[model samples]
Structures are given as structure tokens and as C-alpha cells.
Target: MLAVPLLGLINQYLGFLAMIAAIVLVWKDSPWQKGAKVAATIAAMALLGAVLPDPPEEGAAGVARKDRKAAAARTLTSPSPSAAQDDPSPTTEPRPEAADYRGMRLDEARDKAEAAGFGTSDHNASDDDKNIWMRSNWTVCFQKSSWTGSETKTIDFGAVQTGAPCPSTDGGAIPWPTMPELTWKTWKTARNEVVALGVVPTEHLRADTAYLNDTLPDEGKYDNWRVCATDPLEGADVTINTWVTLELTHPDNGCPDPSQSKEDRVDLPDRDDDGDPDYHDPFPGDRNRNSVFPNGLPDSSGNSSGGDGSDGDSWNCPRTRWC
Candidate 1:
């Protein structure tokens, strides 16, 4: 009986056994006196109450603990509001707005379109699908663009050279400028004819002559040579991108037999008093001896027509005889 109350201090299970033993000793017969048994029963009951865990109470502190646990559980299970906003679903970008590009310079139109997030491509407005090499020299005649709101699109521009007029409509065969009759014409005249129409022909040396490429003094001076034949021939349709080749030879060599037909012969004007025509004379002014007597002057030194008077050289002679 004495040991029962002491054992109850260790754990609830031991305390429960002590309590039961004390109760039996008090109610049923015992070797100890009644007073002793009663005392032992009270001690066992107090110790059991101290050792055992307490049942939950409906109080303010208990409610606060419960609320804290619920908050912790929610933090573990749910995502933050900021996190949800940051990770939104994917979406397509909107298409750029359209605008009329007619009459604008091709280069300017390209810049404007690119700024608006649109890709650009351009073609000659004429019948030929010519490449737009010099954008500044061309003006937009028409534009074609199509796209859904969810997709991107490229703007196709139809253009002509800056000074020319635009076509009546878009997206069809554009009529090119007519190629002029360039056969037997001076290189300068032939070149000007095409350049006025915004085309530059490629010059090729057709005849075997001393003059070579553009490095020579006569390279860019177009009057020094004449066109033998043109690649596309005369009256053919041509565009800025057309492959034009002017087969050329020095004026002294003359054109080849094939291109020298009477119908193709061009009468070159004599711009200066020199007997030689403007195309044949390198120095058209009468100051040069070669220009004064274009045929040949009698040589004082030899039987030859002129002593060392090559095609372009000036001869020093006494002007009194032929004066």
C-alpha cells in the first residue's frame, strides 16, 4: 500500500495500477488500519492526476494554438499571390497595325515598317520583277500585307524609280521601259539613253584594242568609244535590273561588220570645228594638229603620212604650208 502511491509518480500506467490497488485495500479487507488505507488511497489519486496528460480545454489559449497550427498548414499547402501572378500562362503577341505606303521613298518606307515590327520586301512596279538595288532611288507605288491578329506578316512593296509615275494597280506583270536603238551610237549617248530611264548598262570591250578597263584615262570618258551591239538588241523591253551589255570598240577601230548595217548607222554630230567627228576625236578642239588634219599630215622626216602620228598623238609641224 505504501509503495503503490510512490510508484504512481513515475508514469500514468504505473499511477493507474497504484490507484486501483489503493482503492481495493480501502474497500476490501487489508492488514493495515482503515486510516492508513484511506490515506494511501488519497495519495495514489493525487499522484495519478499529476502524472497523466491533461484533456483539451475549450479556453482562449487553446483556441489561439489551434489557429496558429491551421495557419502553418495553409502556408505549406498554398502558393503565394505574387508567385501566381509571376507565372502566368503563355500568350501570342498581337500583330502590328497596317498603313498605306504609297508614294513614300522605298528606303523611308522600309524604316517605318521595321519600326512598327513588320518585315519588308520590295520589287520593281514595272512588268519586269527587277531587284531593288538602290532603295533611295525608288518610290513605293503600292503595298500588300495580310495576317491574322495572332501571327506576324511581311509587307511587300511595289516600287518604281523616284521620278517615274506609279502603276494603275498592284501584283501583276509590270511593263518595263523600252530599250532604245543603241547600235553604232557613241558610248556616251547610249549610256545617257539608258541612264535617263534609271538604268546603267555594263560596258564590255568587243574589239581587240589598246584600251582596257576603267583604269585608263578613256575609261569613264564615254565619247572615246562606240557601241557595236547591245545584248537585248533595239526596241526590247528592259528594266533597271535587266542584264545590259554594251559591246564597245574605239571609234578609230570602227564597229564590226555584223553591227554596221546601213539601217543601224547613227550620224554623229560634229560639235567642234575639227574635221574629225566628235566621237572620233579625243581632243575635239582645232588646237591639236591631229584634230586639224584628221586624215593625215605629210611627214617632213619620212614617206609615212605623219611621222609617229599615232591614233591619239598630236603632230608638231610648220602650219605655213597647210595653213
Candidate 2:
């Protein structure tokens, strides 16, 4: 069997080339001696072919060797999830919780507070401008201190829209809560802190005209209030509970109006250059300044008119009171 297979292999090579050479020699009518020379060359190749291995019989040991090599190759190259399953420890750690108000509008503060376990007991917005005031309550469970009363923590938030002048008018929609200028003012019993986030406008006003005209004598033109502190106060381990009052104020002197009114009168030039009616109240009866009542007095519309406008709902603690 080996001799037959080796002869076939030799014929596939030397015999094929010799046949072509013989055909060429016959076509040229070469001498018969040239054909004998080609035959001799083919026989010499056949003798050398006897050293080569024979083709395997059906399912023979040679065939089994090839099959084993293929199987070993596949085993070496294939992927296995066994190592991954054996690992009990995770490859990656759990991620941290993200901020709740990372990029939302300041007007959404109420919704965020609600989601964070605060109840919206009172909500009001001033018509004169874009100021919104909200009073919310949250239940308290102190670890050590007795519940003489709940502590009141005020989180005053204000938002304003600033952008290129609108082409169509309608005062260009106030972009509240979206691309809004956000300011967070916090009051703890005695200390107050204000923080500004995002792009602030150049013409934003920080002080009411009254305060600017009265307290700051050297003011040329002021717009928007910057946060007084470099860092935000940490809200941790806080006890001694009572209702906290949050009041948004003019960026200038940080004082809440007695009635919680935010109106500011500004003088504008008359159209015809007449001096008689040169000055007018830019924002008259602004609700932002007047929404909070003094000592919880009700207005004509049956709304609280007290200085704080918080009424009995305010948790008046030993150190702080909400107004």
C-alpha cells in the first residue's frame, strides 16, 4: 500500500512535467532519444519518492494523529468562562450616588426638595418679577436631643434667565429652571451663606434700589450678589430641631422685609423728556416682597401677611426663627 501511494505522489509531480516535455519534443519532431531521456528523468523521481510517507488508510493511526492535532489546536485557542465563574469578588466596585440637582432649573428646587422628603406646605410666586418663595416642612427624628420642637432650616433659592436679546419680544420667555441663574442662600440661627452656580449675567442686580441708594454710598452700578463664603456649609450632625425660615433677599444687605415684600422702585426717564412724571414705580405691588406676612397677619386676599408670613408653622427655636 505504501509503495502504491508513494508512486502516485511521484507521478503527480515528475510524471506530469515529463509528459509535457515529451509532448513538446514530439511536436517538434525531436529525435526518439529525447523521449527516452524524459522517461529516465521521471523514473529517477519515482525512486526518490519511495522515501516519503504513504497516505493513511480509512481511520488509520496516521488519520488519528491528524485528528488529535486538530483537537489539541482547538482546545488551546478556544475561550473559557470557567475562570470568570470561579471569581467570587467583583471586578468593579459599585458607583456612588449622583447629585440630585446637578443640572436642573432652580425653579425645580421645590420638586427636588419634595423628592428629598420635604412637603410643600406653602408656595407662592411674585408677579412683579421672577421671584418664587416656597415654605416646606420635613419630619425630624434626632438621635440624642429631645424633641422640644423641630428645627427650622431655610433653603432660599432664586433663579433668573439671561441670554441674548430675544428677536420676537414678549420680554423673551424667562428661561427659568433651564439655563437659569441659580443662587442658594442658607440661614442657620445666626450665620447666612449665599452661593451662586452657573453663568451669571452682567446686568443682574444684587441689591434693591433702596439698599443700594442707602447703604452702599460709593456704588457706581451693581448687578447680582456673589456668595459671601468660599465653601458651602456642610449639612451633617445638625440637631436642636425647629422650623427654619428661608428668605430670598436683594444681593446687597441680606435682610428680609418685614412683610416679605421684594418690590424695588426705580426712576426712569420720561419719553417726551418732561420732568414732572420723571419717576415711576417700576414694579408696583410686587408679590415677592409682600408674599410673606408679618407675625402671621392675613392679607385682603386671605393670604398670610405677617412679617415672616410663616405663622404658627414656623419652628421658633432658641437660636433661630423663620421670617
Candidate 3:
């Protein structure tokens, strides 16, 4: 009729073959009877099935473009609840108020705990594993902290170097300086009790005939020498450069008996039994006839110059002992 709804708006199978060629040309030509050509071919196939256009549904236009791109990606990644209450959420800060940075000074208690917001950390409160390089020379001695927040808080501390003295509690350790009873004392009172316990004394002399004048023990004859066995012996703790040693001997040739054995503690004086002892026998009575202590025997200050008179000669050696 109108070419079968204008060929079904351009092709629904050419409007179903133009509505079957317009009902075979109105029933074989000018139809006007046969029930008026079956009511004009059923009103031209219901007006060409109401103007064509129906072949879609298989993937419905790709599910309507994936539901309009998932509603514009949820409206550009959802936001609005008043823009999520005007955006905020990052936080942290708090910390600050906690005191007692012990006797201060670890770089002014880490610059007063980083000006109160807090952070620092430290440790070695002096078991002397030393190393705090120069944080104002050290001091703090104990301090903790926790209220937790200043971007992760911190505090800790326990230091010690500044003239020492701190650990009796809060993270302990420091103390040191103990090793006292320096044997039978006397190398000038065990070098003034190892310089009043600041440590590092070092004497030695264990009698190789008091170094037959290779000198070095006369702090003005340090009370005729004594101390018997030390090197960390008596009590033991030390630190300020540690060392200690002492060992020496001469209280008229004594000390050496806690079950002897420093080569059986020799006090010298073999008077020619020739096992060589009058300071190594330069004829110490050649076989015991009558040598009232000759040549090599005088030194612990009875002084026949085995040195200290400055170079005694006659091969009794000691011109600083042969150089």
C-alpha cells in the first residue's frame, strides 16, 4: 500500500517481501469482492507489522553498552555524601607530654625529645660497649615513653658517657670500676688503687730479677714494689681503658703461693749450687766457698748499681741494660 509501510522502513526482509506483494496485488488484480479482498489484506498486514524494525535482542546492543558503561563507572568512582563530608581522614599527631629524661644531656635529651613531639631511641648505658660518638658526650641514663602517636612515637634513651655514673636502675649496666683488692698492694699503693679506679695501671715486674736494670718501675721506687697477681683478678669489672695487670713482686721477694707455680715462684739466690742464681752466676762463689752476695746481687735498692745509679758497668750490665 504505501509500499508496505515504505518497505518496512527500508528492509525488514524488504518489508516481508512488501507484504507478500501487496497480497498478490489485491487478490489477483482489482479486488473489490471476496470480502473486499479480505479486508484489504488484513489492513496490509497490520500496517506492515507496525512499521518493521525488530531484529535486535541477541546481545541487546551489547547489553545496552554495558549498562551505559556501568553507569559512568559509578558516576566517576562514587563520592558525594556531601563529597564524603568534605573530605578529610589522614590524622596521627598526639604524643608529646612525658618527662624525666634522666640527667639530660644526650644532646640535650635529644633536643628535649624532639621538641616534645617525640622520637629519639639510643641504648648502651655503659656496659662499655662504648660508641655513642658525640651526642653532646652522652648522659641521659634512662628515659622511656609510649603514649604512642607522633607519626609513630619513640623516646627510649639509656645513655652514659658524660663523666660516667648513671645505671643503678632504669635499663641498668654502667657501674664498672670494681676490681679492687690489688693483691698485697704497695706499688705505690697499687698505683693509688689504680688511679682511684679509673682503671689502666699496667706494672708487671714478676721478677726476672726485677728486670736487671732495664729500668721502668721506679716511680721513685714505688714503696719497694709489691702487688702479686692482678690482671682482672681480685673482684673484676674495670673499664676506663681497662688494662690493670700489676703482678710485680719485691716485698723482699715474697708473694707466690696460691698453690705456687709461676715456675714455682723462684726468689733467686742459689749461691753457687751453680744451678746459676746469684743473678745468673758471674762466679757467685764458684761452688759456694764464701761470696757474701757479690756483683749481681744488690739491686732492690741495696744498690751495688745493677742500675739506677745510672750505668753500673762491669758487665753487671744495666747501661739501660746493654743499650
Report, for every candidate in turn, its global Cα lDDT versus the true structure: 0.65, 0.35, 0.66
**TM-score for all predictions?**
0.34, 0.17, 0.35
- lDDT value, candidate 2, whole model: 0.35
Error in Å for residue 269 of model 2: 73
lDDT of 1 by residue, 151-235 (tens): 6677888898875556676645555677788777777787777766654444422222222321112456546577777766688
Note the residue pairs that clash in candidate 3: none
Per-residue lDDT of model 2, residues 1-323, tens digit only: 23333444666555445445545655466565876766655654554455445766867977898999999998888746885477656567543332343123444554665565543322111122533332222111101111123533223332222221111223233222121212333222122221122222323223333321222213433224322221112332121221222223335344433343334433233343222122231222333222122123344565543334454344232355333
Off by over 4 Å in 2: 1-12, 19-53, 60-110, 113-323
Ranking by lDDT: 3, 1, 2
Residue-level lDDT of model 3, residues 120-157, one tens digit each, is 87877756576788888778877777645435677788
Worst lDDT run of 10 residues, candidate 2, spans 138-147
Clashes of each: 3, 29, 0
How big is the positional error of residue 210 in model 3, measured in Å on the Cα after superposition? 14
